[model samples]
Target: MSDFLTPKATPETAPFWAGAAEGVLRIQQCDACGRHYFYPRRFCRYCHSTDVRWTTVSGRARLDSYTINHRPLRGTESLSPVIALVQLEEGPRMLTNIVGVEPDPANLVLDMPLTVDFEPRGDMTVPVFRPASTGSAEGTR
Candidate 1:
């Protein structure tokens, strides 16, 4: 009873998604310069170094920008996926859909901070984002 949109991942990005299943956010970090990146790659795009390794992040980011997509489509009507672009705190932007939220202008606020959560897909875990707590002593930026 679960037919979710499964993203095609390659060797470069597979570890990232796999980590999500274990409740971790994996991003590539330059072993030489300590620069972190998203959309996992073999080489560091920042310093062009092959000395890159996947590291676990805090599973946190911010809503850089988003759109409230109301257009309904087959297979997407029931879920109402909110397509969005998020900016990770480590300094990279990624295209993903937010979950556990209504796709509305009032809900998708620009520059609103967020944190990552995982959704179970058959045999895999996908990373979704949600509003980050801004009030708690542990959540304050």
Candidate 2:
């Protein structure tokens, strides 16, 4: 395993990290505006409401954009990571990694369906995405 840094949770982000540890993706939802947001802030990004509460969301997303990292990080010289931006089903976008497929433009299709998968980093589990289609690793356009 690579020596990747694990996220240290603050009071505002503890619930999100806790949910990820249990294979659940949690985001903050504004009770006032009914808008969901990510990055685990105390207030809603859309409406700036303090009445935001953490809720579990569908682990489904769409591939919005990405780049293949040809130069691997230290201790991961053999791996070319796919750094991706995914738009969640609930309408928030997050920066995550695409895994279980080749890091090539031919395989990374825009608007491709994705499903969340967790990977262990140090003691914490972080969210990564894989193609939603079964029996194949390549993304479908």
Candidate 3:
């Protein structure tokens, strides 16, 4: 499904969407403390500084936690979803969906490695994660 239905975008999230549309997966990095952050914002959550700028990320992440949702909702149709928390290599954890895999809990767990992939929703590209890169494995970051 398209990300337009998931969450509303604001000015703070505009650049993020813009970058996603370009397959760049831009994330916020604090210029002060050199810490990276997800869920796009203007201030660094750690340092309390407004010295934040958009920076390109490798989109490499690990599966911090997740749940396979088998129930259908009003908006979602036939496909079951894997609601997940992706811990990026830069220390920021992001709430996202796990795509291109079977939605099974045993197959997904804490600290499992992950990598990012873009699913096109109209003109925007939403970042979805998959199993971590295994070097020669398919969809490796």
Candidate 4:
């Protein structure tokens, strides 16, 4: 197993983890404000409404920013991880790893389109992003 720490699902975030296990990206939406958010909380980040529900998203996002991590977790040292912040189609920004491409500045362009994919960490699955272009080389990690 990798030395990377996996996320522990809580009552509020259980749905998100369950969706990822099923290869679906799930986030929370506020019924009252009609807005979506991430990090799994009981109330909406925008409107502070407790009428939030879990919903599956398109898994499409745009690369906003990133940093190439030369030093990764113990077992994942072979994979130079690209830590990225992506803006989802629903307007929520999520911190995820950019995969399916080289971990270099030229390859990690700003505003590049991305699609979600899951990576197994221990017994849990986590979301990762890949370049939208089919021509890009397959994921290195």
* Highest TM-score scorer: 4
- In candidate 4, stretches whose alpha carbon ends up further than 4 angstroms from where it belongs are 78-80, 134-141
Off by over 4 Å in 2: 1-4, 77-80, 134-141
What tens digits encode model 2's per-residue C-alpha lDDT throughout 50-127? 998989888889999999888776776543399999999999999999998888899999999898888787788888
- Report the lDDT tens digits of candidate 1 across residue range 1-141: 146565666888889878877877888999878899877889988898999998877766788777666775666664436878898888888887787677778888888888887776667777778888766433212
Instruction: Work out candidate 2's RMSD over C-alphas.
Output: 3.8
Q: Give candidate 1 regions above 4 Å deviation.
A: 1-4, 78-80, 135-141
Query: Could you tell me the lDDT of residue 72 within candidate 2?
Result: 76
For 1-141, candidate 3 gives per-residue lDDT tens digits of 645355455899988888777766788999999999877777999998999999878777888888877776755753339988888887888888888778877788778878887776555567888887567343334
Q: How much lDDT does each candidate structure score? A: 0.76, 0.85, 0.77, 0.86
- TM-score per prediction, in order, is 0.85, 0.89, 0.85, 0.90
Highest-scoring model, lDDT: 4
Candidate 4 residue 44 C-alpha distance from true site, Å: 0.7
lDDT of the structure predicted as candidate 1: 0.76
Give the Cα error of residue 13 in candidate 4, in Å.
0.7
The alpha-carbon lDDT assigned to residue 38 of candidate 2 equals: 82
Native-referenced Cα lDDT, model 3 = 0.77
Per-residue error for 106 in candidate 2, Å, reads 0.8
What local lDDT score does residue 61 receive in model 3, on the 0 to 100 scale? 82
